[model samples]
Target chain A: MIAIERNLVTPRWQRVALPIVSLVMASIIAGIVLAVSGHDPIGTYQQIYAASFTADGALTATFIYATPLLFTGLGVAIAFRMHVWNIGGEGQLYMGAVGASGVGLLCGGWPLPILIVMMALGGALAGLAWALIPGLLRAYLRTNEILVSLMLNYVAGLFMYYLIYDSTSFWRDLTSSSALVFPQGKNLLPSSDWPGILLGSFTLPFGFVLGAVLAVLLLALFRFTRFGFEMRVMGDSPAAANYAGMRTRRTIVAVMALSGALAGLAGASQIGDFGHVLDPRGLEQAGYGYTGIVVAALAMYNPLAVVIVSILIGALTNAGFALQGPTFPIGLVGTMEGIILFSVLGGEFLGRYRIRFGRAPARAPGLDDEPGAEVAP
Target chain B: MNADLIVSIAVSAIAYGTPLVLAGLGELLAERSGVLNLGVEGMMLMGAVTAFFVSQTLGGPGLAVLVAAIIAAALAGAALALIHAFLSITVRVNQIVSGLALTIFAGTIGLSSYAGQVWGVGGQHGVHQLVKLDVLGLSDVPVVGPILLNQDAFVYFSWVLVALVTFYLFRTRFGLYLRAVGESPRSADAMGINVTRYRYVHTIIGGAFAGLGGAYFTLAIAPIWTDGLTAGDGWIAIALVIFAFWRPDLLVVGAYLFGALSSLGFTLQTHGVQLPSEFFSSLPYIMTVVVLAAASTTLARRRIGTPAALGVPYVREES
Candidate 1:
């Protein structure tokens, strides 16, 4: 049998350097494309980097953009480690926003701290409920969770559209023309806002810290907890998990719920920190939910890796906006993020196999004549 | 509550179902041949935007839809499927990831959005919409006729295409070969079938149909060149493929069913129904989940057929 040995050795530095190399390659290719189109590649890139980091208000925007991604990335990473494809992060996030908004509306006159906690709780539960559909299906009936979760994202979008656009409702504010002009939910009160932390020269939001803490806790749980081990086992092989007498169904459901909850937290956090109300159109390509997938992939499903990668993506996204001047539209700048992700994924090939030039031999029918075939000595 | 309400609802459903059927039939072909494409949504969006732009430029809805269907929509969709085929078939990347990446790359907010902005202003209203195709004598018949025969040419074409696809899948040798490849690529490969070729060709062709569906949306339904026109219809098409049980014929039923559900929300809103419009708007997605759950039940899973290795990348192992 061709066994994948469970070696404890750390991945080599060359493996780590592959993505960087691929990024350089992708940039060079992108430069060629830009040159063909008569745009100055280096000038555009320089502006992008400057805008993402050094410029005033640039860093804050990046953090604001990264806020939702941090939560959703953790959400995706949590489920990914368990080999569960929870593509419903978008839906979960929307549900969380809906839930948080509900709490904010209902709990009038409550203490700020209690209201904030309740808002967060409501969001988490909503996300959990959104994810629960696929979780239950997979646990009980072995339905394809991927499609179900994905469809839910659209469902969530439509649900949000209705929540915001319905005129005669508590969610809608008839108080002004701006609200009338824009079909969206009522804005959050000032009290529900999340306070930011200033780090001398650079100021970062609490969402970043929340994201980091969650990543650390997740990493520790995976490294030290029995629950983590069971998840790892299940990811490797459901048969092995069954053999070990694990409560596979319950574990899958719980893991999915946890994943959904994290995504929900992201949605709720965004609503609390950035906007007062829900705008379905504004959230359509929030990009953070899908961006989280890239982060999780880059991290190789490692929680710590998720944090580092999330920051990188956040920086790139900020740069995309920064590069958006009159000459170069921001949309093309956004294309750079896509380039980075594609390059990283393409680079992943380096970790698994070596490419050889020789043609593969055609093995005859009666070759090993065994169920478990072996590599020739 | 009345007959008129029922007729209006039926009309809206048929209008909505037209695009769904086209996309679903295309998806059925791709899945039958062993590749599950997740880029259908992006392709449709490209088609819709392109058709809207072309119609405005050409000053004729017919010519614009034709160009969009063949060049912009089909070509765009096929281009994405090409990437998917290369990754899943040739280079052997993960099907789900490659497909998802393709969606994000050519996303609603991606290339099409930019294209829509560049096309600018003189939008879909400038183009002539396709005249409804009436089957003369059939038009006078009550409920069924209004919803079926008395409609746009695309609507009739969608059902006809579904029938044609159903026949091709079940009654042809190539169809048998396609099914074999999906069920067991290795076995099919051993039997001298070009596994990669079958997957690439069918996947691309499937994309063409999806693109056509998108063009239909821009030229027929919305009839306007708006950004994000297809919305999430492409993804809905993917879901419909599953709901239809990979059968081309059943796609007609599933498409109409979803189309009806989706339009029912908007129709209810127009009638001043007290129900929250969001509940109606989100019907398609909710129905998808419910249907999927129902289909996944032990009793249903066995009965509902799935293409074996539907999402697996075919890698030719070196001996």
Candidate 2:
């Protein structure tokens, strides 16, 4: 019988090759599923490719989609580096939109640059506030942040819905003929609109540039800063960090806050650049917050790599929208995403272990006798 | 409140809570075996779609179709759980990541939706569904009658399952072995217990339970195939396991309580209680967070029934 054995040291080539191999495997599996469902996988993939890469204005559309993912991915990456599971990116992003909308409405008449800066600060602060509860709980009470953050997502969603759905709420769009028809907030003033760079016939939002700049800043912080080193050390081993004089609690809270701020900025960008209004439907449609988790994971929690992964995911999402039809459903993208993630996770096992087609390694015979026997301490 | 209204509310609560109870019990079993399967949501979705599809296509004697649906759902759930078991238990990947991946893969817009579309089952009602039945001559009795005796077969089945699980976990030798494996796999292994075998069995059994719960959604609750039919109920079930302190008895009570919270909006509105629906809608989630925070104290986690080796892959070598 074949026996799987853990490797003493994984090679560098294996580390790089496994992810790509997993992606290819995932695609093959997905293709088989599509083919079984009576759809042409090759044709579907070509359509996705054509819509995302070759179609007119598709590149610009992808950039728009990538903008929020970039910010959220960075947010997730930073928190993950500190071993904090901040699954509340969706909630934080929504709250950020709320904060940005509050600022945008009040300061709509202000100068363009000042209004933009105010909106960003408002969004960041709102996200920070939202994440603070779980962060503090995790730090002080040793609460599981994963569940807390996830639960908060539902709360944030409802809170946003309540605000926009209320007829008397200031954020509600009074311009609509019937408030009951669509529950959406007012559009931002012309001055608060995000300026875009003209490319051919398409305009790319300034948020993309902002995301690129923040990614570089994050990389620098992780590589050269004392705080980054402490966070990394704390993540690797909390006890060792504590013994070495690191303030673990403070680091946890600070890292979560920073992560929330980035997510909040993503939300603000969604409003200022694309939606231009606080619409619940728009927020749900732009699943950057949830997709950001996948992007972050695909990047292996590296802020720099998040940029490239976000764009790739952004393109896939655009393709999903483009390919929406009776036979070719939008859910194909979600399925592909799930398949890719599972494959990558499984691939990690292959990277760390090797399979030997032979009998088990000889050792002291016992119920657990097998290859890769551990040396007794 | 009038006795009749209270009884009716309680009845609805039981109906709503049945799925949660089933899913929670399954999750508790998995957690007890030191396997944290976050894929409950995805597995439930798969089960739901499978049951719906089977019931739709078969269109036969109501009882037979229901049985078939339940069996198909359990199989679907178990199949997904096997993937989780392999990744977390054998391959030794991060349990959380594996679970999350499974859920995303089989979630509302993933494999479930794909299946629904492929089978032409989307936006259709179940051909057969579980109906509420009054046990013996208890229909005319007071509050207890409707709340306890008048429920779908699944509700009664859940009660039995809970009782069985409670007994198995506390009173049986195998159950003791399973708990030992979860608490300290190394010691269990040293004692000649197959830790891996126990974990695999319990986890798959848990997945089967989750599948039954998912089938309840299409077979009883809504009786229709909708994308995201469970609507975060799986997540709530996961929380319910922790909230109940890993006890099957408490899990039933907690499930019913959250069930009441979930259906509170409809009940209140029907009784002419004027309040924003959002308040009631968010109640279950709010309570989940509160319960998590309350149980999060390090002392509580230790003193409470959380499995000691929960979320940790039990590699014999590492042990």
TM-score of each: 0.88, 0.94
Give one digit per residue, the lDDT tens place, for model 1 in B1-319.
Answer: 9877898888888888878887777778888888888878767776677666666666445645455444666776777677767766665555676677666656655556656655563243745566677787697688877876788777777777777777777898888889998888888989899988999999998888887888788778866766557767887888888877888777778888888898896787788877876777677877888887777674465756688868766655443
* Best by the DockQ measure: 2
Tens-digit lDDT string for candidate 2 (B6-122): 876787788889889998999999999999999999889899999999998986698999999999999999999998998888888778877877887888667887888888888
Can you give the DockQ of every candidate in the order shown? Answer: 0.38, 0.51
| Candidate 2 docking band | medium
The C-alpha stretches of model 1 lying farther than 4 A from their native spots are: A1-10, A25-40, A101-119, A167-192, A276-281, A285-287, A319-339, A356-377, B1-6, B58-71, B121-128, B136-145, B269-272
Q: State the lDDT at B2 in candidate 2.
A: 89
For residues A255-317, write the lDDT of model 1, one tens digit per residue.
Answer: 999999998888777777677576667677565677777667656677877777777677766
- Chain A only: give the TM-score of model 2: 0.89
* TM (chain A), candidate 1: 0.86
Clash pairs for candidate 1: A187-A276, A188-A276
